[model samples]
Target: MHVRTWADRINNLREINTLRNQIFVGFTLTMILVLVFAGAFIYGEVSVLLKQSAEKHIQQTAIQANGRLDVLLKQIDSLTTQVVTDSYVQKLLLKEAKGMPSNFNERQSLLQIANNYMAYSSGISSLELYTLDNRRLFPLDDSSIKRISMNALTQADEKKGRIAWVGIDPRVSDSVLAIRRINLLDNSYLPGGYLVVHVYREYFNMYESETEKEEKNPFRSRELMLLSDSEGNPIISDLDDEAAKSVLAQTGSTVTLEQESMLAVRQQSKVADWKLVLLMPVEAATEGISVLRTAIFVSIGIAALAFLLLTLPLSTMITRPIQQLMRSMRRARFGGLRVIPDGRNYFRTLEINELNNTYNQMVTHMNELIQVVYEKEITQSRTELKALQAQINPHFLFNTLEAFYWSLEEKEESELAQTILAMSGLFRYVIGSAADNDERVTIRDELEHAQRYLQIMKMRLIDRLHWFIEADEQLLQVPIPKLIIQPLVENAILHGVESRISPGSVTIRVFSAKPGFATIAVIDDGVGMDGEALNKLMQSIEGVPSQEPKKGAGVAMSNVQRRLKLYYPNTNERGSGLQIDSKAGAGTTVSFDITIPPEGDGLS
Candidate 1:
């Protein structure tokens, strides 16, 4: 056995010539495509939406970080400017500028001012005052001195007493600095000293900690935040070295580290001239998309199942009645005529209902036509039998005249008169029946007609002829076809008795063998037939035309057989039409049975 592939199964379905299969295939495929397309469309739209949300969240976080950083830097700028511009702090810087070695009291006074500013601002970690020659002026202990870089001094000197905010200082890596020059209080502006304020990284963390405390925190645990210098060197970052490098190398607002794409939003701090960047991994940002995809798949599956369930009833509603109609049509094709009852009300579709109604009408009309044709055929067969009898008139006339001659020679005037009267009665009955439209007559009347013909035959055969008719009184009034018994009796005389040298007798039997049925037979003990002749005789009687026609018992038997069949079309006593029993040199018996119709039933 070979397993069938889906393609093969689909092809088999296509090969099935049915409305249901076709509908199922068409709708199933359409539903599948719709579900797939809908899933893809939903997934695509959700993916874009998730990506946009990640971008927006990251950009907002960067902007918030920048705003807070600017606030911190401004507060530091205010505190440092107060310390640098203080009159006493400026006087001590002037002494240092005039080549006077500052005394302990003077250094202590500058220390006191610096300490005051540090106490006022928590973001200020330390404040260092430097001479124009890069000497540590305030807190003048040589061991505790922090010499400012020429780069910081030159940048401050160019600003001319204005504050210059810088990223994390190289010498003090943990802190960001705000540098400014203190100018002498003279008409000629000259650099008195340099003020260096170190704002610790803890200041930035304090702002970040506040953000994390909010309910909808943009800087979640999965995110990486970085604060970089103008030259793209990171001053403060939560990223490792490799991740920080990836963030700083960004050309656009997105970056990738460790093969995972991240949403990177960078903003430049207005006061500090630093870049604040937020990095959010795509997986963390769009975590809900995975769940959305699962929901989409599940929804599609449910829709498919629902559609399948609906298709069964949908196809059934249309195809069930059609299948029933098809079976009825098949039966009708085989001659079983019937109408679908209440067909119009049985179906949902108007077209199918109309078709069913049309089928019923056609069957009814066909039955009518069949009945008409059946009647015409029966009438035509009876007319043909009458015509056959007419063609035998001269033969019958010659036989009757020969019987009269025999009666004159063998009998006196009274017997001769009886013979002539018998001939006249036979002629009258045969002629009267030929013109009659009704083919059926009572068994008693048919026997009387047969007796007339037999009386004539008795006069002709004399000692060689013998006849007997045993008819039940109850069956005598049962209607059978006209000339039914007479033909069998005549065939018995012609084939069985006439050729025999010994005296032979013909017996006519009319009796009820069972309830509702009557059997009629004409039997003769004379020269009989073999199986071959009997077979031919039976075949001819059954309407199988002979190749070589002859004047034999078969012709008369066929006429009687046809009339019996047409009259009692539904009769099948043993078998239909006639039953003939014979053997070579034995005897012959031709008989039939008729169903007794109810009183007042004219089975026309």
Candidate 2:
């Protein structure tokens, strides 16, 4: 009745305690199935043995009764032979009675001969002779199938065979009759007339009657039925007529009717074409079996109950602690990064409590270590700020000497003085910013630094160097990683224009690339790298594979790359801050992006 698909069963199993329930289900099912099969097998075997024993009893009794019936019929057949041999009866039958009004003396003589056997044999109903020629009234006693009707005599003439058992004769009181026709053949072997012997029903029912036996027989105490096929009619029974017919219609040797729970068994007559059926109530037959069944079921139920009771505590011990641990873990996952506050109270087992305690200590130590690390970073930052400040004064002194030289008049020398003045301005700008740890600078500050450095470079390669700065004026004040662009310019002049035969131009462009982002690109028309060399240089900038050693062509690209990544941090695909595009004999352009926050704010 609990119909579910395999998929549904599997899903339900997934949502349950798999290990404990699997064992319990497997054990319980195995026990139930084994017990059911065992009980069914015993019941079936016992029923079969009891039924076979009962059927054997019925069969033996039916055989004896059938033998008696056959013997009685044979004796009646023998009497017909006696009557035919008698000289008086032969003359009476062979002589035609068709035209004669009556042959009183001849008929009387025939009856007298048959009366000898009739008197002794209680089964015989009557003996009579009839010629084939006529349907006339004779002094014949009444019985089944119209023995006295001329139409009946003519009808009996159609039966060319002999020795038939007839049941339920209308002419008698529920009596059975046997008709035997003796052929009175003349010399030509034709029927002159025939004799009939009607056997009494009492003879067959004699053994079946209650008065016949002293001891009670289980198979026969109840109604015993007998039916013999005659002519074309079915076997006849005297029990509950409807129930009897229904049992007769049953195909199996035994049938148990549900209404009355009666068990009916059918048997075949060995000596006659009859079926013997015995009817007994089911309760009477299986009264003791019901008690046995109850005891067996109780025993099985008790054993199963005991098994389930024992498993309850065992399953709880295994699953409860695990459930508690998962509950704590779930709270930590969804609630907060919280540890078990009281390990001993939370867990019943010692080892589990110890494990919880260990995890709690680990969390505590990790938090303490984080605080120590934060303090150390502040100390290191302050020390680096002091060291950086120390380097700035010397750089300023060199710039002051240039201001003194600005008084000279060789236009070129004055240009050199302007470059030194620009360099000094760069030094002051970098040093006097918000704080040492604040690496974020405005786009305007970065470009100014790059401009000063380019001015200084123009003095070195005055005629050979050409440069330009293009920018979106609105993006000039956007916050960017400090000193990010200035280094790219230095690298371009050093490895690019410095080595090229032709004069090279360095172009710096700062623009608003999109909403909330700014781009700075430095392009140089110089000797670009070959395939292998470019690959090595790109690897260093990207911090993937092994970096090229920081000497020779390494330059300031690596430092620019590291700082840009620290600020922009390509956490999503919208992407890397630094881009290097170059080809051999063409040119190199390095570009990077920076956050363009609101005017009052800077990069976080």
Candidate 3:
């Protein structure tokens, strides 16, 4: 019944979609199963223990009863021996065997002695004496004298005066008997007479009385004892005839009698060829087991109730936050950007609280984003207008420079015209590349732009600086960043040559460093820096702050280094980025490498 209820509950639980209900149902079923199995195991072990204890008790009782019976049989044997060996009885038996008549006084005295023996003994009813021809001798009255079986007589004769146990006296009611043969002490040693001792059935019933007295409680087990003869027929039994026979036929330690389970034990009597069987019902032996079962099930029931009570609230506590979060999200989806109420002060799990906080933060960010996007749109429109207005500035500057160049050529000032033309081309290149937002240009175009920059520089510095350009024609078509080389030249002229008192020479070298790489170097023999200044410059170019900030060359070098890194972000070649080497009053070299892409692959 309990199993069916639990199965039904589990099936119902499966229909519940809520997380709280699922957790509660799952935990409750697990606890119930554990308690049920534990209770069953304990009940089984205790039942076996009770049965084993009953078996031991029954076996002990059987052994004790069998011992008592042996002691009684031994007393009966001794009584028979004493009677057969009596001097008076012996002489009388001899006289009777000789067909001699015995006096009345002698017979009376013998009867008195026999009566005394029976009167003083326990459980002994009467003693019978018979001659060899089956004539009664000692008992003058024949009314109560029970006739013994011929088989008993034969068994006694074979014993040679030893007592032989016969289970019950056949001609007597409720009496058990033993027989012995008297042998004549003469050269012709032969049977003189036979002696039979009768004992009341109370001899067996006395043990049963004692057993009942010891266990006075009528509700306790009632152990039945049966004494069976050598032929397996019941001689004395506490059970009825049929029940005794049925019990005797059973071989196992437990039996079922009268629809009740019984524990059976058997013992053999030493002084008689008899078996004693003891039967005790199992229900009476383990009477307290019912109470134990009740207590266990009740305790399990109470525990399950307590667990259910606890589980409901615990599952609610766990899922309550998530449910609230869901409701909050539903509101936000329909109601526009709105922050969820803060729950940090409430007693809740960390992860759920974190989720709530994250949702609130997202809502706040969305509200702020609305204002930011509005302002950004207005600013973008204004910036676009300004950009449209500024587009003609570069073209205007180039055309004016072009007109100046033509005027100088018409005046035959060819060097001045060439310089103006170089200036105009340089401006166009810078402005065009920036507007396109594409930094890549062929090595040839980059070198030409750098030469134009150097031409303008020479016009300003004159003899203070001399510059030369070296190149490998095959490598001129390799692509590089547009202003990469020009920055290095600017740094050389500004930081190296401007500070020198004597004329300084600057060399630009562009050639293949290896099969797939090109090196562009700007070398200048100017007033080079010492170790401290060089270290400061190096740190500055790598975007590290120095205690003393240097501008001009430092700013140009830093920009060029950043551009080279962005252009070739994954290049692993040793001299792939801007490298600087300088010594005090010797020279400074600024160089970088370009990786040539494969024939058909796009440049990263």
Candidate 4:
């Protein structure tokens, strides 16, 4: 009977598992289908937005290009007008009308003037004069004047004194040469000769570059072409030769260029019959529409997926308190300790809710215990720090007194005695005993302390050093950080002045730096650091880690930096900041600016 009962139980358990597996599989397939559709929709929408942004950007770029092109056209027109009305051209026309001898010198002079102008303007390729009376055209050459047939000029109407920019010559050349006619008469106005200047292609290229700079967008590529006539036969093109020819064949008010689906807008040149064609790729021109299509598809796919895969399961899981507890616990490892929600009857699972309630109660009790321990530890740390400070105070006081005692005992009479007294006073100020005294001590007192330190160092070095302290009397009483000058002096003596063979001198100068600041510099003439060593020294002064400390020196310098930070925390602009200037073989200068805070404001 027991064996039969166990078999029945096994069969029931298998059935339950099979049902759960079927439900999970069905749910997964539904979620995946929804996600796929949603993804497509979101992708479509994003594509649309991107294309629209691109189109707007291109349109603005095009407008800027057009403006620049307009400016270039105006400049060209002005240059042409100046050339036409030039005095040299008028003199040549007058001389030709007077039936004067065909003087070679006079002709040569006129050619030189034209050549000079052409050289100055880099745009003019050639200058020609058409004499109506002679029915001849004179082309200016480097050394001689050549006469050519005036057939092209005969077609030009001079009766109205109208200036004409002729269309591009199909057979003779690819350049667009224009003519301006002036009437010449003796005392009475009559039709005279015409002067023509051929513009170089480089002129147009410069204008194109200027326009491109003004536009400043890289994605939208642009092509500029100058057509020979209004009918659009190519004269010059920024595009490939084949593309230009194909585009010319499709000439219209707005033609779509062949080979590539690009939109071309025709702009008639103001000074000539040539047409300026602006072509933009069709993909670029209608980017907005394409992007919209893509974005719509992507957005729809995302929305569907979110509803199926994310919303349904998340909603069910969120309602379960035990599941919420598990998630919160995982988050706590990353420092996100949060309260777990209480489960209601509406929740899908009752057992999970009961589990969550038990876990929350346990967590609450543990949190109170942790908080008490954390507070106690912090209190203990503060107590220990106070004890350390107390120990440091007495030790420093003992050292200062011992130094003072030795100075008196050794019979160091003059400056040495004064320096020791200053050292004692400085120690008193630092230890809080001198709080009732002037918070702002004289620069003179600071220098005395530095001098004292130097005296002690001189004892060690046996008079191998000299120091100069120079300051204006007015600056002596300006407030400064206590002991600031001493360390800098010590640094120079130990690292700089002492390192040299010859007797070296250290100079301390205090001067006005800028408004609200004063300058203090320690300069030493000794073997200076190389660039790399100087850099390391600067890093240490700025409190950046350096290899020098591991090699075991620079402790005093590091301590100085720490004390500066503690006393003048707000004064340092960016943390760990200091400046040092030095060159190898040349000495180093260490300088810092001190801004005296208002009276009784303390170091910062």
Better model by lDDT: candidate 1 vs candidate 2:
1
What TM value does model 1 have? Answer: 0.55
- Taking all chains together, each candidate's TM-score versus the true structure is 0.55, 0.43, 0.54, 0.39
Clash-forming residue pairs, model 2 = 125-198
Q: Write the per-residue lDDT of candidate 4 for residues 422-458, one digit (tens) a residue.
A: 5565565555543345444667778877876776667
Per-residue error (Å), model 1, residue 422? 79
Clashing pairs in 3: none
Candidate 4's C-alpha runs over 4 A off are 1-76, 134-162, 169-174, 185-187, 206-216, 220-228, 240-242, 249-258, 284-303, 310-345, 348-604
Error of 3 at 239 (Å): 2.7
Query: Local error of candidate 1 at 16, Å?
Result: 3.2
Evaluated at residue 151, the lDDT of candidate 3 is 86
Choose 2 or 3, whichever is better by lDDT.
3
Q: Count clashing residue pairs per candidate.
A: 0, 1, 0, 28
Against the reference, the lDDT scores of all candidates come to 0.79, 0.66, 0.81, 0.63
> Which residues of candidate 2, in runs, are more than 4 Å off?
1-128, 133-165, 171-174, 180-195, 200-259, 264-278, 284-289, 304-544, 547-604
